[model samples]
Target: MTVRNLPPVSELTEQQQRGWSCVWCAAPLSTGTAINLGEQRHEPAFGSPYWWFPRACPDARACAKREVTGDRR
Candidate 1:
């Protein structure tokens, strides 16, 4: 979806809300999902309407890398 015409996060349907996740990383997202609404100058397929969860947090990789990186503060 294009970010310029994307429906507001508040207007998302229940299914959409429940399905919200990082397409790339399969990360669970909440209302806390970061938003950057603006133009659609970039390719829409690259995640125009992106919602990112912190990569530095307790993700799948983090568990494996914890020994080296320790907990992200």
Candidate 2:
């Protein structure tokens, strides 16, 4: 699976961080239909590394379409 570069955690919503929504388009996702982006580790300058599980829509093209069309806020 191609692991695309993820957006910064700080820019993501809590739902995105928890893998409940598409990381790119912020669409709702079900486990069976979502593509797991894998575990992400964020190392801060002053603290321990934080781990996050990210997922995206199965159809990346659609997600990108939504993003480009401004369907997602």
Candidate 3:
């Protein structure tokens, strides 16, 4: 699957709602097994960081990548 970037600078469309769909697997974002990368908050920001676009779910990672190699954080 091709990884696409969700541009944050653009206005939010109805499809952007959290309950809409996942960028990777097209699953509902509300699914218990799904996750969004933006939720991680890697960088400090007062507002929704524009750089944190194309939110991804945990299932987006490949099965081989599920195993942590070095960093747990």
Top lDDT model: 2
Tell me the deviation in Å of residue 59 in model 2: 1.0
* lDDT of every model, 2 decimals: 0.35, 0.88, 0.41
Q: What is the lDDT of residue 37 in candidate 1?
A: 32
Give the Cα error of residue 41 in candidate 2, in Å: 0.7
Winner by lDDT between candidate 3 and candidate 2: 2
lDDT by residue for model 1 (2-65), tens: 2223334444443333444322233444445433232222234455564422221224354335
Per-candidate total of colliding backbone pairs: 0, 0, 1
Q: Candidate 2 on 12-39: residue-level lDDT in tens?
A: 9999999999898998998899999889
- Window of ten residues with lowest summed lDDT in model 3: 63-72
The predicted structure with the larger lDDT, 1 or 2, is 2
For model 3, residues 1-73, the per-residue Cα lDDT tens digits are: 3455553423443344342454434344554655554532223346554333334445546421432332212
**Of models 1 and 3, which has the larger lDDT?**
3
Give candidate 3's root-mean-square deviation (CA, Å): 11.0
Q: All predictions: root-mean-square deviation over Cα?
A: 11.8, 1.9, 11.0
Question: For every model shown, what is its TM-score relative to the native structure?
Answer: 0.22, 0.85, 0.30
- Clashing pairs for model 3 are 35-57
